[model samples]
Target: YGPRTERSKLPRVKVAEPATPEQIQETRRARAKAKTETPTLKIEHKVPAAERRCTVCGRTDLTTIGSGKSSFVNEYVSSQLVREEHVQEVLRCPCGSCVITAPGAPKVVGKGQYGASFLAHLAVAKCADHLPIYRIEKELARKGSPVARSTMNELLHRCATIVEPISKRLLDLICTRDVVLADETRLPMRNVPKGKSKTGFVWTFGAPDELGGVDIAYQFANSRSGATPRKLLEGTSGILLVDGYSGYNDIEKVSSRRRAACYAHVRRYFFDSLKTAPIAQEALDLVTALYRVEHEAKEARFDESSHL
Candidate 1:
């Protein structure tokens, strides 16, 4: 009776209503921006000289006027390949003392038959768009420029060789950042042995970019070894954010390099303990708040703004 009276003496309190699932989802969604259908690459269809004349009277002479009708077309233009022949002229001195020749066309891959633009298209098709080499060969053949599959394979290899220095520079820049995120994922190599299988891993290092993304550089290795990361991160002095992988443990050996916790990995532990401990909910809530803050900052374009 005393306990009931004490409970009744307490003031009445009300709890705020939890947001509906629909409202929560609405808050999390990113609204699409209104699109302006303006195209940068526009091809104008000019009237031919023969058709420029008056159609009804067939008059030869006519004053230039505005267009009779106009309409816009949304189109997908297939890329085409063109053969380029550079003609260099040689000039001889009047006294027959010396000869001079015009500079030849630039070599993208040491006198390679294909131009840089063509090679770039192939690289983007393979790496960015994930198109198979055989598919690319067929597409080009349909477009009237049939290239051999082996030739494309060699061209892609040469392109990778040409960009080796750029890859190193990108890694260097990533290392210069105060905080770097690193991870590795398994992928199968197509060049494995005929009978036995081989597993490959692509380790990626990431740095924050102005476009609200993590600018990443990656390397392919056959094994998930600490030595790989040690070699890749040589001369690096910064904190690394990565999953609790044993391969990254070598980074702790270096006095200059330190390891930081990955929030996603940490959150998983708390989430798994939700059934056992109620206090884990608080930790999960904090992580959710952190993610919300990051989303809001991204929406505000805070990353695009410069500090210096």
Candidate 2:
């Protein structure tokens, strides 16, 4: 009875409504701004002559006024695979001494049926969109252009070969930057020995726009050993921000590279320990507060001294 009476006396906190007035006003302004900022092609619709007659007055003639009410509608255009045929012409002089022929059209894969635009779309679909080659084959079949999976794979390989030089240039540029973010993740290699799969690592290196926007480079290696990144970053001298992976220790020790631990990784450890250790919750809370302060500083575009 005592516990029940105490529980009853405890204060009941009510949950407030989801949105405040300021938030509602901000939402309205955001919608209006989106409408104004979005690029739109205005298409005017006119009333047909048959429907333009007035039903009440039985008048056959009608004219449009200053302006009509406007409404916006979203639309979509489906992607399609197009086929193009190029014809080369040959010419012969009247003397029959010489013959001239126009040069053949350029191809992504030399002497191959695919064009540069087709190869570009195929590469973007497979690499950037993460679409499987088998699925792309199915999609192409549905579009009345059935390209075999093996053929697509060959084309993709050829495209990679074509762009290898550009990729190398990007890597060189990234290595020259003063600061880089590095990480690695496991990738599975299919059809390994004994009909099994093998684990591979993809090492990613990135530099932001402030660091000259070198873009990101991905290097795949069979092993997650320290030597992989050490070799890739051989001549690079800069600060590397990475998670606490002992693989990077050798790079830091041997090269002119400074290693900085990722704060998000530290916070992740505290977050995982919260269930077992109550003190970890306090650390997590502090980290969350720090993130909030950082967010506010970024939103306000505060400089280093101002943030401090």
Instruction: List model 2 lDDT by residue over 1-308, tens digit each.
Output: 12321111112233233556886787788889987887788899988878888999989777777888898886775667777888889999999999999999887666889888888999999999999999999998998889999999999999899899998787767766778888898888785567988888988888765633348988788889988778877767889888999998887766688989987889778766766886776666676667666766654446555833
Q: Assess candidate 2 and give its TM-score to the true structure.
A: 0.76
Q: What is the lDDT of residue 186 in candidate 1?
A: 84
Candidate 1, superposed: residue stretches over 4 Å from native: 1-72, 90-100, 191-194, 209-214, 275-279, 304-308
Candidate 2 stretches with Cα past 4 Å from truth are 1-49, 52-72, 89-92, 96-99, 211-214, 297-308
Candidate 1 residue-wise lDDT, 52-108, digit = tens: 878799897877567555555657767899998899999999999999999999989
User: Global CA lDDT of candidate 2, please?
Assistant: 0.78
Worst 10 residues of 1 by lDDT: 1-10
> What is the number of residue pairs that collide in model 2?
0
